[model samples]
Target chain A: MTTLRRVTLDVLKPHEPSMLAFTERVAEVESVDGVTASLIELDQEVQNVKITAEGAGLDYDAIEAAVDGLGGTIHSIDQVAYGEHVVEERRTLQDG
Target chain B: MTTLRRVTLDVLKPHEPSMLAFTERVAEVESVDGVTASLIELDQEVQNVKITAEGAGLDYDAIEAAVDGLGGTIHSIDQVAYGEHVVEERRTLQDG
Candidate 1:
């Protein structure tokens, strides 16, 4: 079976939880080994954050649930790596 | 001492040495454990490729020399991860 090793997500979240608490909540997901969340932009209503999680076999559903539980909504799945290792996305010539 | 665990580079190379050969040569660098090269664009003159290498402690100078030896030029150091492990770059709101 194919296993997801790492995933980067663009998420929109409220300010109540704080970035630290949001990252902690996501890191507590059963399959996550470690997670890093960075604030990209913030306004009065929401904060746009980038979250990257690494694990042996990540369960996206559970990760999504965790984010939803924290009043966060996934805007997009920016990148994903599967199989034996996590592969980082490289900037290509076509990328703007 | 700080250790560079992974690096992604934007490189331009002639067609004489195929992408496979170029990747193999970079992978053979002393500090490079593994490498993945993907062609981003190609013209009659040169091929623009993205090369990502991972290791315990990567030597950028050596990696540069290897590319230079292969008739390739490093265009840009796209991303780098330094420390205990390789960290994938996440998409931020500021990114185009």
Candidate 2:
């Protein structure tokens, strides 16, 4: 079977649910191995955030439901990695 | 008033329509300034992707609609930046 190894997203959300909690909630989804959230913008009413998830055989629908349950709106998908095997970050020779 | 300046997302999509066309469709939404997309993984069935959008007072709903129209499902929101001014990447002291 094909697996969704990694996914990154842009989210608009309310401040009531802390980023940590949100991240944790997403982490709880089946097949998700880890989650990371970074604050991009914050004002009085809302927060703009980036969330990245990595795992094996990720269930995209379940992840969506979790985020929606937290009152967050997903704006866009920034990146995705998927296949029968795990994903590895690619770097150029300049980095070495 | 509040503004949604930037957003990053993980998306699940079909290969048809091409990434370029999909990106252009999203860019046409009202209030969007720019968009960027990176390929995370590609298999015979689907493509997992990351999409980033930056703009002033972004209309999140409009963006969502456009993405949906393209037969894409947003998997997660990865990051966000918003406020009166533009978003600038913040670096740590170690970087300097």
Candidate 3:
């Protein structure tokens, strides 16, 4: 079985829930062992954050629903890793 | 003692040694468990690569020496994680 080990997403969320609270909510999702959300930018209305979630076999839909429950919108799924372990993305020359 | 878990470096090296050979050489270092090298750029003279080495307790000086032995210069140490486990770098809003 192809297991999702990690995922990184760009998300936009309201300021009502603090970053700590938001991270805790995501970490509570089943299959998720850990979650980290870093504030990228923020305005009066919303904040942009980069979120990374890791697990043995992450369920994307469940994670999405959890983010939705917090009134957050996922801008993009930046990176994903599947299989026996989480493989980090290597920046190629084209990234420059 | 704080153990070095992982290190990502920008390296420049001659085309003589293939990426596979370079990675293998680095992986052979005393404390490194695994090493991955991705081609970032290449010219007639040299190839620029992004190298990530991981282990329970990585020795940076030894890794540097291995690269040096291969006629590779460590352009920059982009990232380093020292702890119980490897921590991914979280991109923040200020990154933009």
Candidate 4:
């Protein structure tokens, strides 16, 4: 079975549980190596944010449970990577 | 009981499942009224994204399951709103 290495999600949430508190909560999830949260947009009651997480063996379910327990919803699953040793794929532009 | 109306998250994902494909998959979740995805940043192997979803009685579990099924992970719960008739909270600057 392929192990998940990294995952990205788009999430929308209410305003009370401040983003700082929320980030701290998610970062504590088991197997999550690191987390970075950036605010994309905000209105009167909600804020749109991008959640990026990376780790050796990411636990999708644990991460989900943490977000749910905190009263947040995932809008979209933006990206994913899996394998024994997942590495960021990068390539330089080749001029024709 | 409080009902969730909107949620925002920060996510990091791999490059294969194009953001468009990812968004399309997320939009299909039950109780999700609408989905908007915007690209935040990209590297050789991964892309960071912000996903916003709005709806009545939003299902955090379904959303999370769908994203995980599609190979994404929730990095952080950025914001959350709950209660009846959830309304965007906006306040004008009052003169001091």
Candidate 5:
């Protein structure tokens, strides 16, 4: 699977571990599945978690829904990989 | 116009404003042009930005590329609204 590097997310309510767990649960954006990625401590109050998943793993709308489902809000979502929209589509096919 | 809530991003390098600025610079993920988004303070060293835009903003692939273009890595991209893949596409349509 293609790797998508640092996709930064902010749990607007607070910097809590539960918020992190929510993202992990709903990582499958649209059709992409998820694999293990790593996280780094960027700051005391925030973390930088990375993962290699099937491109479909990130459903922008779905992700947002998942976050709201968990009672937390996101600030922004940035993908570190450039020119890789297919990565998301790839996962969709896989999920199918 | 519909507003998409928090899309959290983490700049793995550092908790610096420059990193934040980078996200804003390439805020146009792909096809989705950008409108104004807001950010909020969540913790000791984190921010929670929010915005309202046509679903046609936030290209997963493009946003990833934009981040890498800046040198900052992403942790993960979370969409606060679940079941909203159309948001990315809406932005794409707008861009087209």
Candidate 6:
């Protein structure tokens, strides 16, 4: 059986506007914050986006709606060790 | 058996300084960001802190050290639903 592991979704879109739109929607989840969306390359028709949302703020239904709204497909979701980030760090200033 | 579910830790200290000190250390994790520590209550000697960190950046061992370093007790660590907040909410400006 496919392990029900949480993954980080990397979305790609044909335009930056759509990608940004999608990212904005995904950031609305309660636990989600400090989301950063950047453009990668222009050589391809789709723009690349790297999203970092809180495991607490992740919502699948909202993500599906946002992706479809942007007319984009979820290219991939990379599962990182999210638990390591479950604690607080007030010493440094790292944009959440 | 107690499931190994991720939990949200709310730390209390005798002084806001120690609580802040504790929080600062927790934010260093790679996935931790947008950490906010607010004080609550008076009359008593200790301070109350509400910390929100990214699950992706949490480090348990470090948290243990920081908490111990503060010469404070964790008191209570309330388990909050961290995964539901995993999605991005670009639509809102809720600090990460």
Candidate 6 structure quality by residue, lDDT tens digits, A13-42: 767566556677666644455456655555
Estimated TM-score per prediction?
Answer: 0.52, 0.50, 0.53, 0.47, 0.30, 0.36
iRMS values for every prediction: 8.3, 12.4, 8.7, 13.7, 13.3, 13.5
Off by over 4 Å in 1: B1-94
Candidate 4, residues B1-96: lDDT per residue as tens digits? 778877765566677576655655666677766555556677887777666656677898987887777677877766666778655544458522
Tens-digit lDDT track of model 1 for B1-96: 445666678899999799999999999999999999998999999999999888887787899899999999987555555533455566633466
- RMSD vs true structure, all candidates: 12.3, 16.3, 12.2, 19.9, 16.0, 16.1
| Candidate 5: C-alpha lDDT | 0.42
**Superposition error at B28 for model 1 (Å):** 44
lDDT of 1: 0.80
lDDT (C-alpha, whole model) for all candidates: 0.80, 0.75, 0.78, 0.69, 0.42, 0.49
> Model 6: runs farther than 4 Å from truth?
A1-7, A16-19, A29-31, A55-57, A80-96, B1-96
| Candidate 3: docking tier | incorrect
Q: What ranges in model 3 sit over 4 Å off?
A: A1-87, A90-95
* Model 4 stretches astray by more than 4 angstroms: A87-96, B1-96
Error of 6 at B87 (Å): 32
Which one wins by DockQ: 2 or 3?
Answer: 2
* Cα lDDT of model 1 by residue, A24-44, tens digit: 677777887666565577788
True contacts kept of 4: 0.00
- Model 5, B2-53: lDDT tens digits are 4342244433432455433554445445443332223323345554433222
Tens digits of per-residue lDDT for model 4, A1-96 = 335556778888788588998888889998999989889899997888888887876788788787788788887666665433433322112101
* lDDT tens digits by residue: candidate 5, A1-96: 222222445444325644347557656455446535345345665545443334522444565576567555554443333122321221111111
Error of 4 at B91 (Å): 49
* Top candidate by DockQ: 2
Worst 10 residues of 1 chain A by lDDT: A33-42
Q: Is the docking of candidate 1 incorrect, acceptable, medium or high quality?
A: incorrect
